[model samples]
Target: MRLPTLRRTRTVEPGIVTGTARLDRRTKRLVGRLRPGDIAIIDHVDLDRVAADSLVAVGVAAVLNAKPSVSGRYPNLGPEVLIEAGIPLLDDLGETVFQAVREGANVRIDGNTVLLDGEPVAHGVRQDAETVAKAMADAREGLSVQLEAFAANTMEYLKQERDLLFDGVGVPEVETRIGGRHCLIVVRGYDYKADLDVLRPYIREYKPVLIGVDGGADALVEAGYTPDMIIGDMDSVTDDVLRCGAEVIVHAYPDGRAPGLARVQQLGLSAVTFPAAATSEDLAMLLADEKGASLLVAVGTHATLVEFLDKGRGGMASTFLTRLKVGGKLVDAKGVSRLYRQNISGSSLLLLVLSAVAAMASAVAVSTVGKAYLGVASEWWDNLVFQIGQLLGRLF
Candidate 1:
């Protein structure tokens, strides 16, 4: 049997990066299909950190954005993330690049221009650390406007989902009992893996009910645990995870349209519909709170205002409102990891053990009965060492 060779990205010239182009209008969907050395062509405006991290993780040769990576609406973190990862980013290539370039086409990015077969398909600004920093600074100046917009969106979401937010009117019932239990809601967002790693001790000790939101189910599975329940639009999750015997809940639109429900049904799996004007992350938190979870620990869910805006959705307002509603029971995974750090270091534990052993030895040496037992132990040790020496001598 012959093995296929792996394709590696290479610089064709001094400043030109060459690789296969992987194009997608949706950055999230594109990231799933990306391979190392592929040039990612995405249409994400103000590309967020999570997407950038995914691109970096895939080791893409370069990123070609159809829209401005930093529109200066707010200090979005994605552009900086990509630049810092040493990945070349050609920004604002326009939507025409998508029409001009085909998927898996051999492409080269020479400085700020994207070329196919030595012909230029698109041209844009080449973003570096300095450019990204300047954009981020400019974006920070527009923070107040974004905050006002966020406030308005919050009010709009409150008006639309007041019943669900306040009364838990539409929360779905699930077989996994969350009542009086710690609930860990995982989202495949910022630092999810690190947070999960730190929470291993907590998870083992408390045995929290694991609830994975869409791709978060995959995150949990990747971290070597099965979700108790999976909630989301079902786009990013895998079929294997869906069949992992987890209770699935479809996050639907407020009008009761659950696109995810169709996929679930087709997979021969049953799922409950949760129709609310909220993101899947918000839905998971609300469900946990409604289901009577004693505590809700969130991993990779947006916790800051900048993160909410970075998500580039008006629906993030629902997350803000959701956090307020569940604030009492909710705790961030970072906070838990920090506060729940192992109290003793390895050396400290070893030293304490040695101290205890020394105290026991001193007590044994001082007492007649203990001294007699110690003598017997010493004689047994000597005899064992002599037997080992004799066995080695015979073997040698």
Candidate 2:
């Protein structure tokens, strides 16, 4: 058999870039430790927008991906974004690179070749914006196939998760009360910060039960709110968020094999395990709806087709079903700020200012010292006016 193409070598010269190799299979966890000018090694396929954005924020010198940056599966916007940001992307480097290179080892990348101690250890295809753009253009042709596969997956998901959609069978019982109160389920997704900022008033007024999904817990903590419950696979969540005194519920597969539970146990923390086929966000909504929450507000939830695709989700059936179950009581935070009538109106502000002024005046009126000062000021004002008038008459 003919040898498979190793890499599409490029002639464009990339000057030597030296940095420590920080490797992690999970992009989210790896991004936390990435420092500026470090070479980021990741195994993420179809690199999502969020991960790409995080890597850019970390200012990595170059990215060495063990997997294909663009598989022509879809127009994954990540590789393009990285290339456009002038961060060199080297892709399709064999998985052996991870084994051969140790973490924190100083490595040199000349073009797509990774050198360890001046010895070539791995080779890959150098991706620029032109190449990434071409790949994305080609990937668009496969969109129909992707859509078909998505439909098939969604159908399969619907059959498997019917009980979760209708009866809410897998929702776990928690101490956080949701009955007859508003519930805010925050997911760390599209424009989540802005959404939270917009909902500040609602959060303060209603005191909604805060449920954070994985990284969203950290977002809540950062925003000066303590989450009532933290739910998700514990992979992306930080240890500090775990110890934030929120009740942690680890998500697991239906078979009850919880990968995240081990991490929780390692942290010496107690967590409830909820096993289901749906995503953590779906489970959060189900829990709130089943718990008799009067209203449900969502922040950073991926609602659009592009967003679902950006998440590299094969299908959005779970989200669709979850929305159907909770849509009546659910309100998306994207437009909540526009719809929510502020309790503080212009009239209220004017009234408040008037009330403050009247209170101050009343305090001054009741003080004998204030009366004496006012009298003195009044006499001074009259004397100044008379002096000015006499001077003006003399001049005339």
Candidate 3:
């Protein structure tokens, strides 16, 4: 498969573009410190869309990644999004760039080169949409191999998590009333904000039990909805969200080591520790399902092959198992929004227009000016009838 060569439409000249260098090995941590127009330096390999979107939201001028943005593993869309947003992405600068660069230091990117002061430090391939597209196409060729590995992983996961399939074990009891009710599980994945916005009416009407996984809790809070339960390793959730009266569940390793427990303890908050090998998203679904949730609505959860690959999972072993166990009740937020939207047919629209007109007419009828106008219209009709009869009699 031939990958397209990147076009040079928005090429930067071989001149210095200076900005404060914000360096972090962890992309998520660096995002908080990033300021508009600051250059972002990170060590993310196969950069995912979520991180790319966050960086775009922060309005970074450019990105310098120590690892290959694509890595040929699978077509990661992060680099493409950045390039399309007019933020230049320089990839595969080597791990040494992390050590050489300092936070808040003024760095320069001149064409494909990175420099500190006047000295050259690193050079890399600048990526654009064409390059990313071509890389993704090439990556798809390895899907068969990746799928084999994924199947093996899923088999192993099934062996370990047989209870999830058979007896509903490891499901925790929570104070949230989920049994026989609709549940909305929110994740901080692709276009979650928009999905949540689309769900506003459903949320108001159904008032489903809201479960936020990891940073998803913060997403829910940002959208002005308090989570009924928050579940994850607890690393990405903010401090304020932890105290928002939601029942917190710390997902621990299968060996029962809970790292997030300390943070919860520090806040003088109580949390239930649930140990399992599955992803938090899967765990959340299983918990809701076993707890007797009649319906499960998912937001920002991974549903596509590219999205699964972007998450760096060898195969969607846990996701596959979880969805298999809950697919009967699982529905995407977009699906619900579509159903709600489709209900607004032409007849419904006409009814809405008629109702609006009726409301306006009722308001006008209650006003004195409206009454006077009606009286004038009645007099005009009477005079027109009298004139018509006199003309008829004269003609006869």
Clashing residue pair totals per candidate (backbone < 3 A): 0, 0, 0
2 or 3, which is superior by lDDT? 3
Ordered from best to worst lDDT, the candidate numbers read 1, 3, 2
TM-scores for candidates 1 onward, in order: 0.89, 0.82, 0.83
Over 1-396, each residue of candidate 2 has an lDDT whose tens digit, in order, gives: 012222222223546677788999988899888777778999988887778877877778889999998888877778977987778899999897898899999888898799999999999998887888898899888888877776777778889878877887777788887899999999877667778988888799999999999988988987889999999998777899889888999999988899999999998999898898878888888888998999999998877655666678654557867787789999989655556545688999999999999999888778998798889999999999999999999999
Residue pairs with clashing backbones, model 3: none
Residue-wise C-alpha lDDT for candidate 3, range 178-265, written one tens digit per residue: 8899999999888787788888888999999999998999999999999999999987888999999999999998888999999999
**Best candidate (score: lDDT):** 1
Residue 156 local lDDT, model 1: 97
Stretches of candidate 3 exceeding 4 Å from the true structure = 1-16, 334-396
TM-score winner, 1 or 2: 1
The RMSD of every model to the true structure, in order and in angstroms, is 4.5, 7.8, 7.5
Candidate 2: residue 61 lDDT (0-100): 82
- Largest TM-score belongs to which candidate? 1
* TM-score of structure candidate 2: 0.82
Residue 323 in model 2: lDDT = 87
